[model samples]
Target: MTTTPPPPQVVGPAGAGARTGSGDVAATLRATKKRLTSPWATFAAVVLAVLWTIPTFGLLVTSFRPAADINATGWWTVLTSPNFTLENYQTVMAVDSSQSLLPFIINSVVITIPSVVLPIFLATLAAYSFAWMQFRGRDALFVAVFALQVVPIQVTLIPLLSLYADIGVAGTFWAVWISHTMFGLPLAVFLLHNFMREIPGELIEAARVDGAGHVTVFFRLMLPLLKPALAAFGIYQFLWVWNDLLVALTFAGSSNQVAPMTVALFNLTGTRGSQWFLLSAGAFVSIIVPALVFLSLQRYFVRGLLAGSVKG
Candidate 1:
């Protein structure tokens, strides 16, 4: 009766509970941060980074060293002796020589672009279907496709080659293109499907409710969200196809016109193995494009790899 009993004292556990919860959260976050930045963790990371970088550093040093110097001493000797030259690169890239890698470089680009594009394009469609579409035997079919990744490419080479021959496309760019597409599809589908499944079902349902068809949803909604995943897979496929020796040798070895840089580098070893400088230079040449590609898309690569790792 006296001033409404001072608003009923207005006392409860609500404010105390919130403060306690926030304190716990902050304590947990601080512990996590401290653990991540601990000295042992930093040391381990540094050691691993150095171990991985040494060989590539050696390769770079060897690539620039003169042929005589390369054969006589290790790449590390460059720190004291300090000798370098561009002759190795010159010899490998010289147009007048039969060892010229120019044509093979061009061939690699041709083979790689289509090989990367075809699988990604097809796999995106397949992944979308596997993830969102409700059809009979869908799960069984997805498992079957996933199982193909375990099948060795070596085992399939002969049969695939025979099929290509029967179709009269063997030893042609078409054969290599198709072979790479087939070989790349299984992993591509698996990866993209996992990523697609991570996306909220409500978004797809909302689009459908608004009269957007599969094609519209895929192009307009899914594609933008899928950029990181696509770039990650694209980099992986690009590197694999670019550095591939066995596949190129098997499918495109019949002619220089179709063979990629790996095939050319292989021939360099067979024919000019004694020339250490040429091998080093060719190795660097083969790696440059892939390195650049990886660097350019590295942000996307990391994001793509983290897809489906956590849910909120």
Candidate 2:
């Protein structure tokens, strides 16, 4: 052209929005790096890590020690003697003894799976209804559910167990599953509802404009976005149910087929308890799955917590 075209005018809103987004990302990255590199933060993290690892390391070493050595000496002595055996693991895993923990471990798996899944599934639906649907009393209902969290599980156990007994489901896995689901629901719904409300309304509107029904939108859009929240709650429920001894004792303790590993491990600590090695081995056995799960999903858990804390 004879004259250079007038310099193009830059759009304001789009560029501003992009710059804002990048600024937020950069801020977050800088914050993370600062926290990681700070001497005090690094020292605190290492100290806490060492504190946690010591007990676990001791338990693992004790598990490997011979029964005689475990009874006679502290686990720290292993560094000097270094005498280890797998007999404890073999003894605890054996099926012949009435005290063998294998069957109870299986029962734990059975109880934990349903207890975690049912609450999350039901809670997601309830949370969606509360978050997005137009329904009278939605806020009130959510508050009521949130309020239930203050009520102790101890208060509910007696009545709940009695109801289970009347219904003839007492001492069965059903009782434990139902109890865990009920106890978990209030908190689950409260948490998931909060997370659901964080989702961009424009996305939901666009989905609706495309003729997607509630169910379709939930499955295709919300579910994928909700994975972090779900994983966070899933991990919490898994650890709670897996480690719970009181609930299991009340409902399923009488039935060997339904009792969990906690019940079996508790049995090892009672009168005539001489199986320190077995207890140590059993502790690690029960711990392995939960540790693996936490390691695998920890990223999602942390992200969910951060997202929940911040409003987009």
Candidate 3:
């Protein structure tokens, strides 16, 4: 008679577990929101934002102030005795002048574009292979690639320069391009591989069942999901190449035809050490493209950075 009750029937709905999970998630979100909206949190956030913005705002104000005003007082004094001029920017950008930064800007574009593109293209392929393919020594090869990231660029610069010289590309844009691509590869491969591995294995298995080859899966399925990662790495590499002074100085020397804006800006400091107005203007000019690029692609960059941080 006691056994006849046969395990008192569980009366809940089939989705009870799912409902519990959703409830926990909602509670977590609510707690997080509460913490973020607390008065202390709001005050801290405001303080941090103001601290971060002050230096950049000061730099911007200095860029517009006249040379005499810059030399005479701090940028904060502009609140009382505001004076502005475009002469610094004009002189820095003037065409056919010894101090013109326009050509170096063009050279930066040339060096940066290929440096960004080549590493991304190659890293994507390498990451795909490492993530999905089965091959002897694959894990070891990946470890080796990851290890290369720790090797300081300074250590290899001399040897790499010698190699470039032997290959007849030293003192040219090719040398800088190759060096950047080389330095960028290990980090790119590591990040892209981490992102790719986070993708569902079921998708790849389903594609394989549909008779799709590696190339088909990579192009049709993976590429679309990889846009965030690609944009992230592209932005990083672009900024690095664009703002680079050491590589440009090492490989391209002071030749304006091959030197980028950083080298030019550096030389500007050396030659016109007293010209704070011109230096400020050139600094702003150098940062403009990077700021624009970052602002535009920031969403993708955030998503890419969050890759591999969670699991379902």
Candidate 4:
């Protein structure tokens, strides 16, 4: 009353006009920043991509080039000399009716598949029991389990060898598979248990109330959800088993009958001087299976990473 209605402050074109002006300014700034940063990001990405891929590209080129070309000519010459040959691969595989890649790669699969699967199968069961079921000394037991990783591989090598010898599995594929599975169990269980614990507790209880047994719930609900963790572990274990030389050399023979590609590749170089040329091919061959493994399991690997990111 005293102010006689102070101009009845209300929504007006002035207020709307000011807000619209501010919005335009903000949008322009954002667009400008994006435009300015894009080139720098692209440049950095190009540099990184080149650095990351050059060595692998060189290896691929060397594998195709003649040994002399490989030794004398730079891999960069694939751009110029442009000469290509399969002779190096032929030479590496020619002697004694050996494909060089075939038998050793097959042997690696035999050793690695079982080793990776056995540990994962056993670890999943153990992890489920550890995470969901209440039992005696559970926490202490888990700590002890995790602590096993601290034990050096060398520390148990002799004991494991002796055990393998007693079991008559020494120098056999079983020996290496068993050895790898045993060594890999602790970490596998640890990783899986941690992943399982992050699952909502109510889901498990709901399964329980539905009259589903623990085994049923695990196989039905938990296993499907653990896909990511399983994939992550599988890729890691497969690579480990595929590339392992020490365990393979110790437990399996060097005859290439049982030895994996890693051991086979090692023997490719000798007093004839380093067969660095074959190394280029052999390294790529060895990586193929691991790449396939990752590609096949990558979906779950991503899920497993995100599973624990948010709490209920």
Tens-digit lDDT string for candidate 2 (1-312): 799888535433334354655565666667667877999988999999999999989989999999899889999987877998998888878888865788988999999999999999999999999988898898898899887877777888889888998999999999999999998888789789988999999999999999999999999999999987898888878877998898898889745699999988887778495688879999999999888888888876664444323210
The lowest-lDDT stretch of 10 consecutive residues in candidate 2 is 303-312
Order of models, best TM-score first = 2, 4, 3, 1
Q: How would you encode candidate 1's per-residue C-alpha lDDT over 1-312 as one tens digit per residue?
A: 565545423223333344655565666667667878998999999999999999998988899999888999999988888998998899878887876777788899999999999999999999999999999999999999888877778898998888988999888889889988888898889889988999999999999999999999999999999987898888778877888888889889736689998887777778745666877898898899988887888876565444312211
Q: What is the C-alpha lDDT of each candidate?
A: 0.84, 0.85, 0.83, 0.80
Q: Against the true structure, candidate 1 has what lDDT?
A: 0.84
Please list all clashing residue pairs in model 4, or write none if there are none. 228-300
What is candidate 4's TM-score against the reference?
Answer: 0.80
Native-vs-model 3 lDDT?
0.83
Error of 1 at 71 (Å): 3.3
Clashing pairs in 1: none
Tell me the RMSD of model 4 versus the true structure.
8.1
* Model 3 error, position 205 (Å): 3.3
For model 4, the local distance difference test gives 0.80
Candidates' TM-scores? 0.78, 0.80, 0.79, 0.80
* Number of colliding residue pairs in model 2: 0
lDDT of 3 by residue, 103-173 (tens): 88888889999999999999999999999999999999999988887787778878888999999999898
